[model samples]
Target chain A: MLAGLARQGVELPSACQAGACHTCLLRAESGDPGEDGRRGLKPTLAASGYFLACQARPVTDLRAAVAGPDVITPARVERRWWLGPRVLAVRVRPRQPVEFRPGQHVTLHRGNGIIRVYSIANRPGQARRDGLEFHVRVYPGGQMSEWLAGAAPGTGVGLGVPAGHCFYLPGQPAAPLLLAGTGTGIAPLLAIAADARAAGHRGPVTLLHGAAEPARLYLGEHTPPGLAGAGIRWRACVQSRGEDIAEAAADELAAQPDPAAARAYLCGGRGSVTRTKRALFLGGMSLASINADEFAPAAAS
Target chain B: MVMTSDPRPLYDRLGGKPAVDAATEIFYRKVLADPVLSPYFDGVDMERQVAKQAAFLTMALGGPNHYTGKDLRAAHAHLPGIGDEHVDMVIGHLAQTLRELGVAEPDIKAAGAVATSVRDEVLGR
Candidate 1:
């Protein structure tokens, strides 16, 4: 549905287009989203006419649009910081407060319609009321990366509403949690850990973040507040010369304690996520219990 | 005989790759733990087997048939003691996995029917 709409010049911003991330869920004003489309959705949400566009084949002609699709909140870049040689941090304050869960993602559509999906690094509820933050890996000629690397404060950008499935829900509040990420993938993980702590979760959270070198372990510089205070254990894995992210992730998975009841969230490149999910499953973790968000490069529609 | 519009493929109605992948992993675990079926997978590379099974099930369920692995009869030819009983147990475990995942009864029966349709080839009969 999204692709067809895109072909007709109505571009929809999407990432992890496999329906793993709810990046393209839209409201079907008057149609039935087929059976598979209703899987994993709450009965209430199903009744509310929400459908994942990637999987929805409408049984009837439908009026579909992103939730409040007409509203494109404009945000201005307020700050930029380099987390590593190639990774940059961007902070933007929306014209209005954008409500989103800590681990959700937002798509930024440039004037030319180049839409890029970025994971929001700010925790919801109590992070900052004024703005959104993201960690971006600068690709030399990448349009969004180039613009983001040096976009001055006050430069305007459009922020799409946030959507994702990997956010921290207060499930089994004390459920053992496992989080793993690589490079900028740690952005969402950082927020999730904060949210867990803010929610006063008493479970053990084992966070394993990997970078190619010590310097690239961006979030390791200063432990975010409450990470240690809330008893969340964090480890940084580095491969100074060449980062074998999957290997580092497997090493992390190997050390998880009693993973049976743990709800795990893994983020990183698709290859790493796939390998890690496989390893975790073979290591006695249920595949259903492991939620993953693979940071696939947002493709041009 | 006339053909009608292609009916909704079973794979889509039951959920696509993600759903099938989840079911395969859980089902494979059960198959490996079953005393009768566990022996058949003793020295097999389970990771690859799990993926192949998922692809097979996806194709069998009327999704894009990307399974290019061994034909069922050829694949099971050399296994010791492979028979209808083993096939039944494997399919039973799969049905149970989908059940555990909260798949609706109709879809579960549809999936079981797909497995039954393949009995001859899987059992090399």
Candidate 2:
């Protein structure tokens, strides 16, 4: 069965060839299936034939596909950069043509043979250069971080195409947009705001960027030049000065009329993202209208 | 008020680091083929990315908190261009990962809820 799928060029999700990550999950359309040690599968899914393809070898001829229609494809790295001590930017191109709404992320295959995920920081069409762009921060001693720090330009890498669900939805033209981001987390938010402006969006757009210190913010030069005159309000909040940028932004958002009508996007440290969401939700924005992404260090290995 | 039985200790239920490590690897392989989600990893270093994710899972699942690194927003601020579809794509990946790990339906739902809770911070919608 595996040979047939490979012959058909049907690639399944996998990571840690040692039976980890569980990216390739499928349900048996019809067949007797066996299971192995990969975690995350529920008895219900198992009873219904759900199994991780990486861990399960077909006992008999098996017919299967991902339980959901969402299939992940590998992306090729087109660019790389060292933004700061720990931040890196990698641009990836999809093996196939694709489109995304903005504020999404893709999983990356590092030189050390590990797969990590990062957010898309370039506008949808703007990535026309060769591949999509991603912003990553390296954690000291992190498998990918150490490799990226020493990697020279044109280094080959692996990636998964746009994978996150956080993005902007159209049809709320009159509603105010409050976009807040910290460090690399700002990548997706910036893409959303930029796309809105480039597409001639007319709603009031405000961007509040925060970092530990002013120097930590990386994309000052790459900020969309179009937003300066496109009615998109931009602000930088440096939290090291003891000013709660997220709180201030939330307060400003609260002052707006019909807070429920406003849409808020918050990205950054887990603490700030959590605080911003709580503050804004309590300030009256509808929970459905709020979108966020939180990036933090991996738990100890 | 009496607290409900908290299932916060899901790491043990999911088979700890070995299980999580395996699931993380499979999840990345799937992400690579996903047209909608693969673009974000264009120039990424896959090895380090994998380790960071594993470390993150370790901490997220209430295991040992070894992920002493920068927060998410700071790490991703450079790209500055993401959207709704991207956010949704990530959530979908997380959901798929959970499904692959053999996590129970209730556990998967709980994990989804955690992912949903952070959607705003991720997409900046």
Candidate 3:
């Protein structure tokens, strides 16, 4: 029966068939046990009727549902560029339109079968065409970076859309907005700002961008020139300079009125994002109003 | 001298910093020409990112620990939400890059496994 399923081209999630990885563990709604102990469900998970389809043969008819979305489509590599020696602006677009909150990311498939994830840099409505965009910084010898450097136009890449929980929730439009980004992570904040502007939001939008040096900043050209005129004020901080970008952003936030009623979004290198979020929270901004996304380096393969 | 079956050091397998740097440069060029991802990188600085990536890789691949940089998660915390699909695409590009560099098949697979391990962390899952 497993052969039949495979012959019919039924794909299932699986890793480490010995059940060590648990990638194929699935909940069985209703089914009777088959004789083969090879049926990969652990005793504890099996008591709850969780079984591995890879190990379980379909006998006496079975019913099951996947925990997550069944179909995994590759994201398209829409563009790429070097923001600095280590920062890569890898813009990705999915084949389908994915709906997500302001701060979130998707997983991308390098041609070599490695998976690297990046945050969505554009908002739902800001794509101007189709699919969302993601900005990625390539760490040397990193899987995604290597593939991107050598890929040509019209390459097929895999992508899992709209993952991650951090995002801006809609609330009273009058709340002040505090936005921050470091390196390629700035992509999402820019998207949110653009979305807010397109929606004609009148709230004050302050964007604080930081980098190790002025040369490392990405997406400066794509930043809408009218952002300031649209009531969105942006300030850039070079952290290698005497004053760090987070410090400048905090100072700018302090000068604003009623900061307690503001919503803060911070993105960038892990340290910068953490520092900025802590500063905002200590400055009286409610914890619930602050959203953060961390851009971790892809571990060595 | 006979080549040993034991794995070569990552630096040797990657052909040193210069080879990695070349690969990085090629990756950005591909990204810029792509129809879907191009708009995001328009007007971005490519030279600086290439240099930083070389340094980061040198450390990651066990050559030298010269990467004095910010943590990854904090840097991307402010981005628009990324989904599973986007992650797959990024991974695909990475795999292609290894192939371009003439990396051994086993090494490529090992590299891919490493990238896959961190999917949840990078995607904020």
**lDDT, candidate 1, at A195:** 86
Q: First chain TM-score in every candidate? A: 0.80, 0.72, 0.71
The local distance difference test score of each candidate is 0.73, 0.65, 0.60
Local accuracy of candidate 3 as per-residue lDDT tens digits, B1-125: 11125476565566666766666555544544455654544333333544654554454344554443234454334557656666566556656766676665666566566556656665665
Segments in model 1 whose C-alpha atoms lie over 4 Å from true places: A2-14, A20-53, A58-69, A213-215, A221-228, A239-257, B1-27, B30-125
Please provide, for model 3 over A1-301, each residue's C-alpha lDDT reduced to its tens digit, 9 standing for 90 to 100.
3335557986554432432223344555676535342243335445656555556665676676643333346556676667556666565566666556656666566543365666777676665364566666665665667668666655777665444545665665777888888887777787777666666666788887777776766545233563656777877777666657667766877887777788888777667876676566546564557777666554334
Candidate 3's docking class is: incorrect
Ranking under lDDT, best-scoring first? 1, 2, 3
Clash totals for all models, in order? 0, 120, 99
Instruction: State which candidate, 2 or 3, has the greater TM-score.
Output: 2
Q: What is the C-alpha RMSD of each candidate to the true structure, in Å?
A: 10.4, 18.4, 21.9
Identify the candidate with maximal DockQ: 1
Better of 1 and 3 by lDDT: 1
TM value for model 1: 0.66
